[model samples]
Target: MRRGARYRWVVLAVATFTQAASGFFVQGIGAMGIQLQRELGLSTAQLGLLVSAAQFVPLVGLLVAGELLDRCDERWVVGAGAGVVAVALGAGALVPGYAGLLAVLLVVGAGYSTVQPGGSKSVASWFHASQRGFAMGVRQAGLPLGAAFASAVLPLVAGAFGWRAALVTGGFVALLGAVAFMTLYRRPPGRAVLPRARTPRGVRMRLLREPAMVRTMLAGAGLISVQCGVGILTVLYLHEVAHAGAGAAALVLVATQGTGVLGRIALAAWSDRVGVGRQRAVVVCMVAVVAGMAVLLTPAGRSAAVACCAFLWLGFFGFGWYGPWVAQVTESAPPDRTGFALGLAMSVNQIAIVAVPPLLGLLKDLSGGFAPAWGLLIAMTLAALVASVRTGGARRSADPAPDRDEVACPS
Candidate 1:
C-alpha cells in the first residue's frame, strides 16, 4: 500500500512532464511572432491564425482522443501523440513559408489533442475526489509551465541559431518526454483490466444535456477565449502599444505564463479546501480576470510596470481557473465517463480557442488599439460569471459519484 500510494505522485510527475513537452513548440508561437513577422512579412491576423491553427483541430480531435483513452492505456496514447508533435515540429524546421508552418502546426495540434485529455484522465484516475482538484491543477500547470519555459528560452534560441533551431529544440524535448513516459508509465492496480464493452454514444451525448455540464461548458468557452487572447496578444500589445522592446515584451509574456503555473496550483489547492464545490472557485477566477482586463483598458495599462502587473493578474486568474473548472468537469461526469466529459467540455472550448485569437487580432487591427480586444474579453468573462452564478443552485445539487472505471494500460 505504501508503494502504491507513492506511485500516484510518479504518475502525476510523468503526466505533467509529457503534457509540457507535447505543447512546447506551439505555446512559444506568440513569443516568436515578431521575428516571424519580420522574416516572413506576415500581418497580425496571419500571426493570430498561426496560433489558432494549432488549436483548430482540437475541436474534433479531443473528442476522438477522449474516446480513445476510455478504451486504451493512456501511456501509449499520450506518448505516441507527443511523438507525433516531435516529428511534426522537426519536419516543420525544414519546411519554408508561412503556409507550411501552419500545416505543420495543424498536425501538431492533432497530436496535442490527446495530451491534455489523456493527461487529465490519467491524473484523475489516480487521485480521489478529495484531492483531485489539486492533482488536476498540477497536471494542467504543465501547459503554462512549458509555455513559460519556451517563451523565455526559445526567443534566445531563435536569436542565436534562427527559428528553425528553436523548432528542432522543441522536437528534441518532446522526443525525450515521449520515451520517458512510455518506459516508466503503468496503469494503477485494478485498472489494468480493459472494459468489457464500449460505452454507447447516446449515453455520452446525455452529458451535454445536463444543466451542470452545460454551465461548465459555457464558462470554459469564455475562460478559454480570455486565455487565448492573452497568450496570443500580450507580447504584441507590449511591443507595439506600450513601446517595450521585443526582449522585454517576451519576458513579460514569460512572467504571465510563470504566474499561470503558480495560479493553477494555488487555485487548485484552494478548491480542495472548498471540497467538491468547485465552480465557485471558477467564478472567482472569472471575476478576477474581468477586473484585470478592466485595468488594461485604462491608461495605467500603458505603463510598463502596470501592464506587467495586469498581465500577471490575468495570467493568475485567467489561466489558473482551469484547475477548479476541470475539477468540476471531472466531478460532473457520469460513472466511468471522466475522459469523455473532459474531452467533450474542452472540445466545446476549442471553438472559442480557435476563433478568439484571430478575431482579437482583427479587432486590434481595426481599432488600432488594445481597448476593444480587452473589452470583448471582459464581456465574455462577465457573461460566464453571471451564468455560473445563476447555475450555482444546480451545481450544488449536481455532484455525481466518482467514476469507478479507471484508465488502464492494455495488455
Candidate 2:
C-alpha cells in the first residue's frame, strides 16, 4: 500500500480508539442506573440529570473545539481533551454525593466536547470524498463500541467493587487512549499550513444560515433525541416494563449498542453506493427508527424476545444514522470549514441530547409506563424524515449559490 493510504487507516484506528475511551464512563452510566439509584438514593430525574450534565457543556464546548480544530493540529486538541476526561473521571471517583458527581461530569463534558469534532476533523482530513462516508462511519462507531464494552464491564465492576471503582477504571482506560493518540497521530500531508486563526463570527453565523446546515441541525435534534432516549431509557424500560432482570436489561442495552456499531458501518458503506447518498441514507434510518418505535408500542413488543429484537432494531437504525448524517454535514461544509460545520451542527444536537433523557424519564414517571416515551420518539423521528426529504431535495437546487465563498480543498 502507498504510504499515504496506510497512514490514513492508522489515523482512523487512533481516532476510533480515543473516541471509545473518552466515552467509556458516560456510556456505562445507563447500565449503572439501578446501582446508582440504590447507592446514591437518586430519583429518576436525578439519574437522568447525571447523563444530561455530561452533555450540557458540549453545547458550547463543541463550537470551541471545532474552531480550534480549524486552526490547530488535532493531535493536541483531541489528546489533551481525552486527558481531561480521564482526570475528571478520576476526580469523580472521590466525590461525595450526587452534586459532586455532577460537577465532575461537567468537567468531563467540557473535555469531551473536543473529542467528537476533533476526531471527525482528523478523519475527514485524511479521507477523500468518495470514501469519507465509510471512514466517518467507522470512526463514529467508536461511541457504541465503547458503550458496548462499558455496558458489558461497568455493571459487573459496580456489582463487585462499587460504582466509584467503575469510574476510576474508566479513567485509566481514557488515560491510555490519550497517551496512544498523542504518541501516534499526525496531520494529513499537503493540507494547508496556516497560522492558527479564529473563524470569523460573521462567517460562523453565515454557515448556520445555509440550507443544508439548517436541515442537518433540525434532523440532528430529532434523531439525537431518539438516540439519547434509547441510551438512557432502554435498560430502564426493559426492566420496568418487560419484567427483565437488571442483568438481562443491561445486556439488552449492550446488544442494542453492539448492533449500532455494525449499523453505522453498514449504513455508511451503503451510502457510498446510493443515488441520493448520505442524506437519503439518513432518511431511511429515520423511517426505520419510526418503525422500530411503533413496534415497541405493539402487544407483540411486550414479549421479552420481541422487545429485545425491537430495541436491537432501534439501536441499529437510530444510532447508526449518525455515520451518514455526519458525512453529509462534513460534505456540506466548504473544505476549510468542515470542523466548524461539524462543531456547529453537533452543538445544535447537544440541546436535544441534554434535554431528551430527563424529559423522557419525566414522561415515564408521570405515565407509569414506557408507552408515552416510545410514542414521542416515533413522532419525532417521523418529523425528521419529512424534513430530510424536503431539505435534501431543495439543497441540490440551492447548493450552487449559497456557498460561493467556499473554496474546495485538494484531495
lDDT of 2 by residue, 1-411 (tens): 267667888899999999999999999999899998899998777888899999999999999998888888889999999999999999888998888999999999999998999999888777776677899899999999999999989999998999899989999999988998999988765555566578888888888777787777788888999988898888888888789999999999999999999999999989988877577788888888888888889998888888999899989988899898888888788777778898999999998889888888888888888889889888887887787667775654122222221211232
TM-score of every model versus the real structure: 0.95, 0.95
Which ranges of candidate 2 are over 4 A from the true structure? 397-411
Candidate 1, lDDT over the whole model: 0.86
In angstroms, give how far residue 32 of model 1 lies from its true place. Answer: 1.1
The sequence of per-residue lDDT tens digits that candidate 1 reaches over residues 1-411 is 557667889999999999888889888988988887887888878888988899999999999888888878889999999999899999989898888989988998998888898889888877877678899899999989999999998888988888888889999888877887888877777765466355577867778878788889989999999999999899999998789999999999999999999999999889988744787688889989999999888888888889899999999999998888888888788646777888999999999988988889899888888889999999998987787778766734355553452222111
**Span of ten consecutive residues with least summed lDDT in model 1:** 402-411
Any runs in candidate 1 off by more than 4 Å, and if so which?
196-199, 395-411
- Residue pairs with colliding backbones in model 1 are none
Give the lDDT of residue 123 in candidate 1: 85
lDDT of 2 at 89: 94
